[model samples]
Target: MTMPFRLTVLSLAVAATLAGCNRDKADETTPPPAASAGTGAVVTPADAAAPMAFESKTAFAEVSLTLPVAIKAQPDLHARLYAAAVRDLREFSEGAQADRTEAGGDEGLGAYDKSIEITPGAETGKLFSLVRTDSEYTGGAHPNSSFAAILWDKALKREVAAADLFTRTGDLSALDIALCAAINAEKKKRDPQAETVSLTGSDMWKCPRAALVPFVLAQGTRPGKAGGLVFLIGPYLVGPYVEGSYEVTVPQSAFRSLLAPAYADEFAGEPKPEHAGA
Candidate 1:
């Protein structure tokens, strides 16, 4: 979490007093450090400057962005990632405003707004996760939001998707079946009120392999030795949006057989025992 930001546009000019508007207010300010060896223009927290902010407000809507401290630690990697996040936010905000304006500017629009918050997650060796959460309110019955947990291979400065963690078996039907049961089991285990539901052959059972890409990852024996891969599924993915978001954690064991050789050791779970017949 960084500093609280405010971006209000439209005729409403949403006053700053709006609830939960100014959340992260920056305190200490720092500057980018001198370039280091191979890091190029990257800077660590110590040398990184304060959050960069962008704001726009009109009678019809508002748009604002507070950049996370750019890393520049690995060439332009940090900056590039941050830029992508910012670009998404900008498009969400500005696009809505444009659409509304074309529709003759809703006479009763209340704070057509959008905001993004970035936070750091698990980091082991050169692998790290950057979690981005977006919350926005157009003229909807409720606010719309989303979360993306990106696992990055910092050493290589690229993103790691779920498929990359496994070997291409040409067919993932088995993996899909196992994950659905696992997700349903976890859900019921955590929720006392949840019914014992069989996800097999159900639409809910279709847990996209992509859904296993972790928002947060850590060491464990379940999903793999690398730990549990927790995929955050928003409303409508598993259930209606009003039902809220859901998390299905596929332990390393769930797909151990499919684990890529490169990732197998990292995601290895408990060792299988030798057969007594042997």
Candidate 2:
């Protein structure tokens, strides 16, 4: 609900909101916010089903969220969506306000831009995910950035937890291991001479198991009927911040035994082994 990670620092937050982050890099890449679908696109009942809106008193941060416009819209649709949007905006407002406080007088506290989008892949809107990103520079030499994602089953009107995608909680444990292996493998392929990655140890290990659930949720854990459930890690989560966060998608077949009834039919699409490599 409140954002899953702090864009200001690199921590387990990528996996589930690490408590600490260091070094505010000047040129971190920020994902572009989603734009209006505009009035020109063909309209359908589904389109009318989920209407998105935003509110911002200043240019610092804005929230883009979906709400039910029809009287017959699902019972709690508007409430749920609005609640999610508000949570994000609150986090943004708090972060910006904190930066303003640091300004010593609240003047030109640098720029903070936070954006959100509900419908992705240009889908029919029946199934969508929330994509939120923030790029902020609060008087620092550079900016801090991070992206967070949470999938919503429009039809079900509930978040699709990482555990929800799999058959059981333990299945996620297996997935955590697979994800780490996949991420480290990605690091290796990108730079054969790159440092070894591990999330289990501090000094040299890449990440911690504690970050697994939160990281998965923040990564916008979503199911691909044709592919597999995908985990989009932000820059620096599993590697150096310079390396950037990335998607470590696995094939549906990789977890065929663990697929939930919802996505048990999926059988294609595995991220290219080298896809996450630089």
Candidate 3:
């Protein structure tokens, strides 16, 4: 069986690290390769580089990303704290009191099933959330999907709520664009044969259909680790900001909640297949 893309890569890289702890950190010093043909600028780092992986046991997908200096390698001010927040959220799912089931119609795909959303707020700190969702097939031959969301601090430390998190950090415009390009480059390497390229908003990329959307990178430190954080950079969709338009007109609040600690939750409940729509 094809393991979730993230978990498979995570296992390999974890094994590699355990087998040889002395290997140089990939993101610390090495320079990343040039940007794709026409996406954006490249990112490099200040320390030695190392290998990193993102995985999910239920998603049947795993992706390996470089820890090169540019984007993944930087030692942000809040990196350690952000990492802890991610770990906490992951733990929350295992012991959460509320496990509500919700479903709704989503574009591209019809309905999402067996989902739970959690919002966490801290006194004098940022806002963040944990969300877990699963998509199952009704008639079409699509494989089931499980996803988690997480938000971290500016330095990438403790996870915070969306309400407080953004206020504490700088505008993510440039960072968002740079991250999309980096992830796009990684996907290209993973599936060099993948055809077209489409970038929308900030981070989404149409690796196959040329559809683009906003994307973001979520980084957190490993549980009990000293100086490193796990980075999950991928395609994400967000509401576009229009000139002279009210921000409240869109679901920015909900989307932000889905982005961070939301990734830390668990979606291990057995999924129930439902009747498809006509």
The best candidate by lDDT is: 1
Evaluated at residue 148, the lDDT of candidate 3 is 43
Give the candidate number with the greatest TM-score. 1
Model 1, position 188: C-alpha lDDT score: 61
Estimate, for each residue in 166-233, the C-alpha lDDT of model 3 and write its tens digit. 33344445434433344445444455754323444334433221012211222122221111111222
lDDT of 2 by residue, 1-278 (tens): 22223653554335233222423443234434444458556544333433456667554444344432431244344445555666777787778767666766446443465555443321123444444554544445555666565555656666676566567546455555666676777777778887766656576346435235332221122334334444567666676677876656555455667767774543344433333222
TM-score of 3: 0.27
Residue 122, model 1: Cα distance from true site in angstroms: 2.1
Q: What does candidate 3 score in Cα RMSD to the true structure?
A: 21.7
lDDT of each: 0.56, 0.51, 0.29
Regions of model 1 farther than 4 Å from truth: 1-56, 63-75, 189-216, 219-225, 268-278
For all predicted structures, in order, the TM-scores are 0.64, 0.58, 0.27
